[model samples]
Target: MTRLQPLPGGLPERFHVAHAMEKGASRTRLRASDLSAPFHGVRSLSLGEADTILDRCRSYVPRLAPGQFFSHETVFVLRGLSTPEWPYVPRIHVSAHRPAREPRTHGVVGHRLQTREPAIDVGPEGMPIENAVRAWRQCGRLWGLDDLVAGADALLAGRHPIASLGDLEEEVALMGDVRGGILRRSLALARPGVRSPRETHLRLLLVRRGFPEPDVNVDIFSTRGEFVAEIDLAFAAWRVAVEYDGRVHAEDPRQFARDADRWAAIRDAGWDHVRILNHHLRGGGAPAVAMVRAALIRAGWRPGL
Candidate 1:
């Protein structure tokens, strides 16, 4: 048996077999036990090593046909938006500019674009992908109203937004025949400065249960105009803040300490703060909503007033 040379570290996690052959790897070596054939003519050292959905998608980019760009959940992954876990869909999504036969490949889902739709762009990793707003609209086919709102909020968040709410609304108007009700509802519910999907979920739970929609990631200041803290969701007048604590807060010692201090400061400022954990958000968010509702009542918020 011929000895195989070790793969170079400079090589991407996934590469074409031809590239490997060019780098002096023999066909027999490319087919070694350590290599995986993720797509036709594409090889990976370890499929498990491609931990993220985007990593797995990038592995197959060299094999994508002409005029193809990622869309739907795949684009969600590419744009760094929140997405479902691997095996949720278990297929890479591709969208072609023109009508084409659905790819017969077992692990791929293909879509056709409408005429005169926005042009696709090459993403940071050189993979072809739809723009953020367009991709958010495309995702409506797969995601429900709440998930879509979360996606839109992510797209239009922070000082440097990838896409604006108006841009998303225009895309929805252009794609008239797709996901009508869910798209409109998501657009109405979507707000800027939402940092994560869990925040969006918590906000939706409150509003859906008839609580006045709280502002997203608003800053609360001390009486002397010093910034006390920026809260996840706040009913400013009511002085109630609803915060979603992801696992990172507990896992990172420094963050946990900072959060404790921040909570104490907010409490000292005469604001009622509600901390929401992942478990409180499960099911219908009854416990979390009840907690926020109680805080709101204490802060002088009434349902019909």
Candidate 2:
């Protein structure tokens, strides 16, 4: 018996099964344990576990037919929006517009999208993908109210924003009773210029608890017209500012000193500043609301019925 010839090296990292066979790969060699079938009719050189979502996405790219693109939660991660940290890997969300058969493979949650709705766009990887508006709208399939708002804020206000408040409003109107009104409620509460999901949570916690909605990331100026600071959640009318200070990044001494000076200046300007940390929002967020409420009251805000 002769040892079978190894597969050709120049066949590309991920190759279609038919293409490999046409390139002189023997059926026996193609069926060997050396190649793993990540999807039907597509094989890959071992990328063990495919731990990250993008890796898994690329692994399945060979099988994506025309008109099919990534959507929903997958787009959230791919586009760098905040999502709940799961202990295990989540399935990829693949989608195609109406009349197309959606994928039903393991490790995939396929969506049959509305025809010509929730528009599509190209992603950073050059793959066909759902636009940020569509992704934010589709997240209603799996996300809750606060998360939906966070995702909305990210799409409309993040660096290199893909949508505007008008875009979101348009999408929500088209949704037409999606989630039995969850999308409508979230959209009404969603604010632009929100920097992070934690900020969204903080804002929602206060409003739901009867505090007035705060202006998101608005600039505050001193009596002399000099910019004092941009408060994360500014109650400008009452001279109160609420900010979520989740500084988990590696400390930059220069940035820290600048922040220290900024905080001091904010206080010196006679604005009541409420600094909210991770623990303040850990549970029911009552503490965060209470802290903001105290600051607002100190700044002369009165509750109304």
Candidate 3:
């Protein structure tokens, strides 16, 4: 038996390699022994080079005699659940598979891939199995939480689940859970009939930014519940009704005229109406929240919760 030379700072050579690379070493390579630590030291190979880290690792794929591997998060990134924005790589939550042993580094610094699946699928980028499994798992959790709740609510109320992806994002942000974002994205892509894309995105931004959630397509009715008017988003308590006032509203003469009539009717019925345009959504979320907050405050909402 031979004792391998331990990497500097008592870290595995791969870990050292990854650490050094992250601190701005543009060009570096590793030998097999550098990855010979427990769990085959896959973390050492993870140098933060976003697009090419996997590509660089392919050189050793043909040499993966046995037991050598990559990290699970790395696999997920390659598959696309998380975008690489530098500093913090998107964390993939995969608690489904149990690891036989602990990883060398707990997070982005360096870590090993521990999965229950037998025989990882390797390619030019190494294990596609890891990325695919993680992506699928995240997607499942997302649908299980957000989509199921929203879909069930919509169905029971006899409402359509055809909402925008942006709106789904906001709902997910509000719930502060993976389940929400996943289901929202999945449902929006699969179903075609929900709110328009822009409206959905605006809805999402509003909710994610800690503003009070607004009702979508709220129907104002008579005291007998006979439908009298329809509004895009409404804060009934504040009597604040908001319309998207989109390009269609301005482009179509009939729609423009009808909108004026509708606002007048809403005013007559004692609702304070506020109209928003696409540009407002694009520029001033904080202002929008402030305006809404101000109105809600005037209507007797305590400022600090």
Q: Evaluate residue 108 in candidate 3 and report its C-alpha lDDT on the 0 to 100 scale.
A: 25
Best by TM-score: 2
Better of 2 and 3 by lDDT: 2
Candidate 1's C-alpha runs over 4 A off are 1-34, 45-51, 84-90, 99-102
Better of 1 and 3 by lDDT: 1
TM-score (all chains, Cα) for each model: 0.86, 0.87, 0.38
| Candidate 3: segments with Cα more than 4 A from true spot | 1-194, 222-226
- Residue-level lDDT of model 2, residues 195-303, one tens digit each, is 9889888888888888888889988877788998888998878888889998764288888888888988998887888889988987698788789878878778877
Q: Which of 2 and 3 is ahead in TM-score?
A: 2
Full-model lDDT for every candidate: 0.80, 0.80, 0.47
lDDT of 1 by residue, 211-246 (tens): 998998988887777788999999988999889988
- Prediction 1 TM-score vs. true: 0.86
lDDT of 1: 0.80
Better of 1 and 2 by TM-score: 2
Please give the distance, in angstroms, between residue 221's alpha carbon in candidate 3 and its true position after superposition.
2.7
Backbone clash pairs for candidate 2 read: none
